[model samples]
Target: MLAEYRQFVLPRQRGLHAEIIIIPTGELKVNIKEKNNSLKAEFDELYFHSAGKETELVCRDQLGTESVRWHLHLANDDARELAMLIESAEEEFEALMRDL
Candidate 1:
């Protein structure tokens, strides 16, 4: 059988902290830990723009929803991996659109 998608989990330092995952279908699954509550957002849209050492992620769950911006500090390797994932997502989206 052929794999339809790829999945990856972002590495973190440890302990209870926020985590991010790239789903097989290309969406982002993010979990944030708060003082008394945890919040999870499955973003259908992800826009990544990088400048120098700073990377900005614009995420939205759906159309007309308020978008959230996240500024992430990533190592060189991490940044490269993220860029690849974004590219993969875009490619997949385009392919799906063409297929429909």
Candidate 2:
């Protein structure tokens, strides 16, 4: 999971990049934006769980205090497929940020 985080995403230039930490519970966090004088648009307390064939991504925001959840199911684990998934995710995230 840590390897995936490091390989798939780059450092956030304007906001904050996703970071993975190994503590009491493995977690992932990202600072997506800022508001006022406080850290805003940050996602934390992320918990990833895998079912039989799907993975779940759950996260909470620091400022809005909202929770977002998503899931991914992979049919095959191949380099090309993985690349496409990462690229698609990045494009989607970028579009979302632009909309905000």
Candidate 3:
């Protein structure tokens, strides 16, 4: 366990929303929800690509069925926190890769 993040929700189309949770093991536990319906997805490896004021969480899940490219609209403070979390996740990922 290296780092963990608190839950954050971002709105999507048609009342859908994305709930993002960063685990200590560098895995993103995501829950896409709308009303009473929800779907969960996990990404063990994530790439946070930033451009201008937008940031994208890039990852592909198993079965070749789930593709994730979450566009995050974060406030200034939230963006800073997210950046720190991403750095921690990247460090943990690198350590795990080296161990393999």
State the lDDT of candidate 2 residue by residue for 43-69, as single tens digits: 244434455444444445545566554
Q: How do the residues 19-100 of candidate 3 rate in per-residue lDDT, one tens digit apiece?
A: 6566645556656555444333354444466556555555655556566644344434455676687667778877887899
Q: Which residue runs does candidate 2 get wrong by more than 4 Å?
A: 1-77
Error of 1 at 51 (Å): 3.0
Clashing residue pairs, candidate 3? none
Model 2 per-residue lDDT at 9? 28
lDDT of 3: 0.55
Q: Which ten residues in a row have the lowest lDDT in candidate 3?
A: 36-45
lDDT of 1 by residue, 1-100 (tens): 1112222222332333445556545555555443233233343566566666545555655566775644334444555676676567667777877898
Q: How many residue pairs clash in each candidate?
A: 0, 0, 0
Task: Give the higher-TM-score candidate: 2 or 3.
Answer: 3
Q: What is the lDDT of residue 88 in candidate 3?
A: 79
Which candidate, 1 or 2, would have the higher lDDT against the true structure?
A: 1
lDDT of each: 0.50, 0.36, 0.55
Candidate 2: 10-residue stretch with minimal lDDT: 34-43
In model 1, what lDDT does residue 9 have? Answer: 29
